[model samples]
Target: MPVLVAVVLVVAGCAAAATRLRVAAPVLLVVVGALAGLVPGVPLVEVEPDWVLLGVLPPLLYSAAVAMPATSFRRELRTISGLSVTLVVVSSLLLGLFFSAALGLDLGWAVALGAIVSPTDAVATAIARRAGVPARVLTLLEGESLLNDATALVLLRSAVAGAGAAVSVGAVALDFVLAVAFAVVIGVVVGRTMLAVRARVADPTVTTLLSFTVPFLAALPAEAVDASGLVAAVVAGLVTGHRAPRVLTPRDRVSDALSWRTVELALEGAVFLVMGLQLEALVVDVRAQHGSLHLVLGVAAVGLALTVAVRAAYVVLLLRSARRRVRHSAERSAWLDEVEQRVERRVQHLPADGDTRAVRRVERFRARVRQARHDLDYVLDERLGPREGVVIVWAGMRGAISLAAAQTLPASTPDRPVLVLVAFTLAGGSLLLQGLTLPALARRLARPATADDRASRTRARMHALLDEVAAREGQDAPRVQVLRAQRTALLDALEEGALDPDAVGHALDVLDAEESGLELRGEGLRTS
Candidate 1:
């Protein structure tokens, strides 16, 4: 218990130091852990793979998914899937072949090592976020990191199983499909059921408690059925986040955010610290096993180079595609406008007392056309170019997840210690190489002045919206009522794609604060 307390203290202290120094906390924590491990009396910390995979990962992913704007996630789904799924598969396979030839290892074991290192860490993307990378780039990075784990882990499991027996490509593919399908089902059920329960509960404390159980509730059942628990947690989080605004009270939402942010910090900090501390022991283990430390380091370096090269190539293609889409946006917009006009004409022809079902269908079709046009406009406004592409490529740093996944390898697997060391070195090297340089790169590739101008305009619009709501609600309406109306307006703007999600989020925060203040004042008056 004392050791645990000390670990927490160390993590908190390092986080504070990082904030003060304007450094990435994960990078700082790892460095601190490594230096502290070298102390004469510090005990060797060995983290069980289960501790990280089962305990730490689910909540971290869940929190991130909840915070991810549903609209952005949907907007970037195609790009996100390409990175998280296709890129991972390609990187893992290519790296596996390279490792096999370079190290003379078995194909299955080599592929397992490849899978371990393929997924980028979301925690590391905090560096990119702090560096002021554009929102679309951050969305891509965050979404990739959030969803890629399932792909990598499933590949890892297949590789490990193949090592002992003949596991066919068909079988592996089937496994992945079933895992995702089952996890999605489990996640949706758990997410909706828990939201229903939480909505009925009056106490914010109880609501928060139920919220805490959500990730695990989604994960545990998925894992029980040999599915991807992390994916289940992510899906549950997305559902909760998308639905919470309508179902949960503002206080409940605020409480969940505050509590989950704290949990993310502590858990993420511990993972990195433990990652650093374990490096010394891993080194010792490889040495004890008569493996050349230098050889493992070389392999890790080569592996890192391979992954980076693949990512660069993939991102270049993505950028080219984005440029093409932007180039042709005017044509697409015109076409969409024509389609919308036709729909409007059709709506005009429909009788007011026409068949209700036919009218509803047409209305839905018209809404879809409008939404498509809005989405296209959003794409044009935030087009990615070479600079954004560079940021995306460079920010693909590996961290705790690689090390944790590596540690999960079977004990009897060939060169297990060596493989673990390679993963550790790769993660450490990536963090130092990429995380350290990302901020400078971001500054160089900074978004244009127009981006800031757009943001300012959005903020002005938000204020205008609030004033309009106030005027409509009337001066005699309660302050809380006015705040609620403002929040509803902000949400409406967000849905219509008329406001930036970040701007809407800030406006919502202001409304929540104002409402809370009014409630407090009312309580004071009643008491007096």
Candidate 2:
């Protein structure tokens, strides 16, 4: 425990430095861990893969899902589904074939390797976000990464169970369909039930405890029934997050945010650090066993290359299809607008009484046509183009999930050392190679944020904060009224240009903190 504490302290320090330098935190932590492992008297850390899957994964995934904007997620559902499920399955198959042929591995082991490395890591996605990737592309990548793990894991289980034997494809497909359906139902049921429970509890501490517990509560049962726990956790998060604005008090949200961020940083750092330590140990193990380092490295390199290539190809094809559809929609929309205008002009020329009804009818038709065009544009806008697609493709760098999945592979698997080495090396190489260049690529691909975009984001945040303040009911209402009045005065000053925008923002934050503190005390009083 003492050594563990020391390791965490060191990793935390490194993470802080990485953030300050604008480098990827996970990559830096991994490098630090590798060095730590190399130092004499520094014991190597070994975390059970099951610990990660059950304990670390649920909360990390839940936090991310809750943090996601529920409306945007729903809006981009189709695109997210394709990238998360369809692309993951496709990439896994292609990589499995490549690895099996290239490395002379059994088909099942090859498929397992493919599944192990397929999903884009959340750590890599975070690095890409720092690189200035567009919000839309980032959302798609995040959504895809969060859900793809379950898909890859499902495929992996089948491959591992088959042990290189041919499995029935139709049966696998049926299982996938059923697993998703069951997972969604279970997730929704758990999430909604938890929301009600939290609402009644009223005690902020108990509410926070429920927030932490809900992920595992939702996931483990689903996994027990052979459904996708990843999907369950994500669904639960989405449902809870959508309700959180109303369900959780300002104090609860603030406390939960701080606690979760701490948990995320610690777990993320520990995962990568342990991986680096494992990599160090793995290198020594392979050398002692007289295994060919060159062969393992060669296969890992090939596997990484194939993973990126498959993703890039899929992105290119998807972009082309989306572009063609957008062009078709625009053309049809132009024709519709022209016809609508012609009808209105003809209606205007008719006799007064007869044309009045016709004019109103034409107006209604035009409104519907306008709405149709808007709907089409909304759908098109969510689809990835070449630039966004490139960002998503590069953001496919691996992290904790890949390493954890590698460790879960059964001991009897052929070339076990080789597989483990490749998994570790592939993950590290992705971070060092892809993580290093992702920011540069994202910057090149990203469009600059427009003024309207900035304003929209600002407006949305203000409304959300104000809505929370409004929703804080009970014994604290009197104190809340004063805070609200002060907030109004700040807004008035900002509107009059008497106060700087930044100053008003800072003041509002301070006021929000004060309000939250009061609410927290009130909740305590109520509990007593």
Candidate 3:
């Protein structure tokens, strides 16, 4: 425990530095663990399934889910679900079938492994948000990462059991359905109860505890009943988050925001750090070694190649299909070539005096404004209610679990157990490697080519703020010129993607109507 604590402290320090360097925290955690392992007496951090599948996953999922705008789910339910659910099942089967054929693992065992690996990655997808990726891609990847794990896990358990004995196809199918349904139903019921309890509590700390306990309560009961613990945890979290805004006061939200972020940071660090330590255990048992390390590496290489090939093919198909559909819907989306051409048009607009820095900030806010607009339209066009709850639920990807599961190998298997370990290592690596990197790659590939009305948006908000202040304090709102000056400064900061919507909203609030030289007797003055 002391050694682990020491390592964690060192890792926490490194993670802080890595954040400044713009490196992913998981990447840093893994590095720290690797270094810690080199010390002769540095012990490993041992984790039971209870710690991993139960303890860690729920809080992480909750923190991520709470921030997911429920409205987005209502709007993009079909597209999001298709990517999260259908894609997960398809990818899992492909990975499983490939492993079965290439590694000589039976179809069942291979499928089990595939199911385990299929989920995108909750941690990676969540982390990608900070990397300047578009919200739509983050929505799909993060949501899929959260939900796909349970789907994969349930399928894997079914596949493994069926692979061994007289289990029927009916049996596996029943297990899969029951696992999901039971967990969802249980989670919903428990989640509603928790929300009710929280609505009655005014204390922030107590309410936060209520939030923390909801997932575990939902998960444990579901697992105890042979249902999906993970699914239950996720659903419970989504429900709590879905209800939080309405039921809890702003103080509650503030408390949650702080607590959740701390939990998120610590838990995420622990996850990758622990992974590095425990993955060290999936090694050779000298007495009954399965196969040559070289052979395992070979299978892993094939598996990695297959994953990349499948993913690339899937993306091409997805992009093509989406483009064809987009052409019919909006009439103006750029073709791939056009999008590239747009970069040229945009580049020419760059200030020749090397003010790329200023241009870049303007460009970023324009991008955010575009996305904010897209998300807003989605909220409008889609009929999102509780049933439209697909966003938070579907956003459940499982990268960390898959990595942790890789560490759970029995250290020995079929005289060629090395093959299994190698396959897992390869698959896990691809998941970490691709999952961590793909959003960035995807953002680069398909970032929209057009810009939007940041200047106008800034002006409009400033006007609104000014009008409100004039009403409140009986003073004229700030002048249009002053607001414009403030906006110029704000846009400069926002261009580098440093602006928060709330901060922007607050900027709007700073413009008092009374302060802007407009006044009326018990009536607000409108901005010019």
Clashing pairs in 2: none
Q: Evaluated with TM-score, which candidate comes out highest? A: 1
Please provide, for model 2 over 79-152, each residue's C-alpha lDDT reduced to its tens digit, 9 standing for 90 to 100. 78888888888888888888799778888888888889888788766887677666567778878877989888
RMSD of each predicted structure: 2.5, 7.6, 13.1
Report the candidate with higher TM-score, 1 versus 2: 1
Q: What is the TM-score of candidate 1? A: 0.96
For residue 93, model 3's alpha carbon misses the true position, in angstroms, by 2.2
Model 1 score (lDDT): 0.88
lDDT of each: 0.88, 0.78, 0.61
Q: How big is the positional error of residue 182 in model 2, measured in Å on the Cα after superposition?
A: 1.5
- Alpha-carbon lDDT of model 3: 0.61
Clashes (N, CA, C under 3 Å) per candidate: 0, 0, 33
